[model samples]
Target: MFGPTYVFDDPMTLGPEPSSKIISHAHGITSSASKEEDASQIVIMNLAFNDGKFNGSALSVLGDYPFFQKYKEMAIVGGSGAFRLARGIVTAIIYTYNDTTQNEIIDFHVLVLHY
Candidate 1:
């Protein structure tokens, strides 16, 4: 599925817990991979910040995320507002997941450079 077979708008927080500080929101689309290669998922994401200095800025991230791994790194392609011309790497880690609800909590460590 090249289109948004899996569309999501998940909260961006400082920590992995639900009670973590909400700093932004991540709106993204992930392609549904074939059963044999489902371990690594492709994602295109945009993080829209709404708090503090980063308010109104957005970051575009794209990469292949291997969920089973301890950490997955994604590229910070570009951005708007404060993060304009941004380019960097974001390390993602799965914090928690609920099988019944299909809910997941991920932690991201972003190292970026911008104009």
Candidate 2:
């Protein structure tokens, strides 16, 4: 799936800002017959930021549980532009989950230390 990402001036206040936008695309293979089943998935995602920053990663999700006791961390193995040579971590938190719709909202926090 693909969508637009917004930035907020004051995240605590839910303020809005035109900071930058992102286009993301993910390709994956699912082991479950349907989303309602307990399964595992291997996915690769590519992110392109409007400010000329880009990053991509390959991640695996092994459990059907929607809530995590620990934040999931993925490697920022490659990137471009301001994030060139980026090597850091991307932490994921499940912000929301709807069992009826089988929809999940995840928040990602990226920390990059690059040259």
Candidate 3:
């Protein structure tokens, strides 16, 4: 679960490399994860957004870098606050276990809007 409670320390990284975005919230208050067993597995359960401006830039803090480009063109509906912001927000709970010694993992992004 990703929330305002899971705070990650500075110099964030899986091991020696620098992580793109480290957890920056306190635990058990907003979101919770089981990192004691398999630290690599990240579970983002919910994403909450406060009511305010609706600019595209406001969605930047929703998650980390390399967000899905397709989400920008999508739309969110329903009364639930979660869905209200989900339309423009792109949230992905990724679980990656890369062999750092063999290949360097790379995130690819492509933006396409057919309107």
The numbered model that scores best in lDDT is 1
Model 1 root mean square deviation, Cα atoms: 2.2
In the range 27-87, model 2's lDDT, one tens digit per residue, is: 3232322243333232234334432234333222222222334466656666656556667
Candidate with best TM-score: 1
| Local accuracy of candidate 1 as per-residue lDDT tens digits, 1-115 | 3333688899998877788889999999887554554466788999999999999999999998875779899999999999999999989888888999989888888898999
After superposing candidate 3, which stretches have Cα over 4 Å from the reference?
A: 1-4, 8-30, 33-56, 60-87, 93-115
- Candidate 3, lDDT over the whole model: 0.27
C-alpha lDDT (0 to 100) for residue 54 of candidate 2 = 40
TM-score of each: 0.89, 0.51, 0.20
Per-residue error (Å), model 2, residue 21 = 7.5
Better of 1 and 3 by TM-score: 1
Clashing pairs in 3: 5-25, 5-26, 6-25, 6-26, 7-25, 7-26, 8-23
- lDDT against the true structure, per candidate, is 0.86, 0.43, 0.27
Ranking by TM-score: 1, 2, 3
Evaluated against the true structure, the overall lDDT of model 1 is 0.86
TM-score of 2: 0.51
